[model samples]
Target: MISEGRYKNQKAIIVENENLSMSFLPDTGANLASVVLKEENFEFMVQRPEREYRRVEFGGDYVEAECSGMDDMFPTIDRCYYERFPWSGTELADHGEVWNLAADVNVKGDDRVDFTFHGVRLPYVFHKNVSIIEKNTVRIDYSAENNTDFEMDFLWAGHTMLQAEPGTRVIVPEDCTCAQAVFTDSGRIGAYGEEFDYPVYRDKDGSLRDMSVMGERQKDSEKYYLKYPLTEGMCGIERTNGRSFTYRFPADRVPYLGLLQNFGGFREMYNMFLEPCTSPFDRPDVARLMKKNCVIPPRSAYDWYLEITVR
Candidate 1:
């Protein structure tokens, strides 16, 4: 069932089952504020310990808030002006347009909740539904419809940041052996726009690094996308205690996967993001130039889904 709750001192709406519990901040960015795996007595989502939520404007920085749980990144993830005519030069927010705004909530009353947000600056409506479809599985479905007569270009990624600790192992398809670097905070990787070996890499200091295993808190951070679409369409992290959770999606629909490994570099927090996006680039403008933007045709909608299962 769904009820009122609080996450990080912000007002929240909660949806729970006997095995799992999810907290949401419907009015503040339609965020999935928290996720708890009841069987493991674990808080699945990262909680930036001791940080309070900060109020922000439409064009404000996403980092200004308690950067935890899941925030819907729509239309664009990075702030950039619209790339096409009719809306060119229209600036999108730092982390898309939906965050930090009140969303209309529709409770489905069966361990499910729906949130709808109309673009404040663009021409579309975004809808996301959270469902506890199985005892230990949470499913999220998303659809965005173009409201204008002309087709539109957009990107939607669920920015779910999971709690990380030393020794946690990231699981990808066994045959996948490479990653394309998009962002990195250290010289361990070859900086941005580079391709590197998967899970193992030689550090700048000439040390062999296991990229898949989470390490202790430090100033190091790295992010990359799977160089190619997964043949199996799944990824997960096996925890120190052997308990784990995996995300499954259709590879053809959401062909790109991003890993945001932040041991401590960004805000001194330990967390990692499993980003299933439509494009490899975080900036839509850049993605458009790279011919990777997903589009919704006039009077139509595009859809995708994600599922998380815990062991």
Candidate 2:
């Protein structure tokens, strides 16, 4: 079944099965978007938002923002501000504000397509859209198009938040190395000048704690890359024991993946932001310096995919 509603300034799409219900909010305020697949003893919430943060709290589940403002979404050691190209005068508002649903999406069951404004860009047009293909393994395809005549820069990242606890552990394919952690507060540190191999761990009072606390790192890297064929993606925090879940993105389409941890104090709420992007945040100047930004030609189309499966 399918249902539609409005929450704040955003629009939501709800899909359900015999055992579960899924909601998709195109607006940034609805940070927790995508599938809510549940069956028997399993339940999972997959998030795919541009930016998500909270106020008056160090960590909880991030509140999606209406616009890119100082107090809106807060970037973490894992997730950061994703800026698209062109130039609209406003930072967060650069991508436009409305989510346009294709007429066909109103129909229910299995196959559906939806498009979002994704904000605005000055001289050009920037928008992100998702297409859902339902099956044993549901498919979510993403794409960002440049409607203008000039080349545009694109930064597509996923702020995937997960719920966790003290006993919660992460599992990633062994060959995958932990990339440097980018803190929103400290700007860019660690691998200041170059990219290096790093492992995933926790910081106690700004110091690296015991690696064992990170659970077991996979011994086989090949198995990890098996899911993501084009680029190397990491999987941490296995959900086998605790209330855990997994989200997958097309490795070839989304070259990078980011895993984030958020502790809710009582039960421990963790978020794994699986970012699929052409570049990382380091300022436009830095992106230009590193030659990391993707130059999307006008009138051209680029496509990507994300999948959520709850067991």
Alpha-carbon RMSD to native, per candidate:
1.7, 8.3
User: Residue by residue across 1-311, what tens digits does model 1's lDDT show?
Assistant: 77887876688888788888888898887787777888767887877667577667678888887778888888888888887867788898888887777889998876788889888889888888888888888888888888788878788777888887899999888877888888778757786778888878777788898888988888978888878767777888888888787889887778778898998998888887888888777887777777776888888998888898877
**Model 2 error, position 194 (Å):** 7.8
- lDDT, residue 10, candidate 2: 53
The true-versus-predicted C-alpha distance at residue 277 of model 2, in Å, is 2.9
Candidate with the greatest lDDT versus the true structure: 1
Q: Name the TM-score of candidate 1.
A: 0.94
Best by TM-score: 1
TM-score of each model, in listed order: 0.94, 0.62
lDDT computed for candidate 1: 0.82
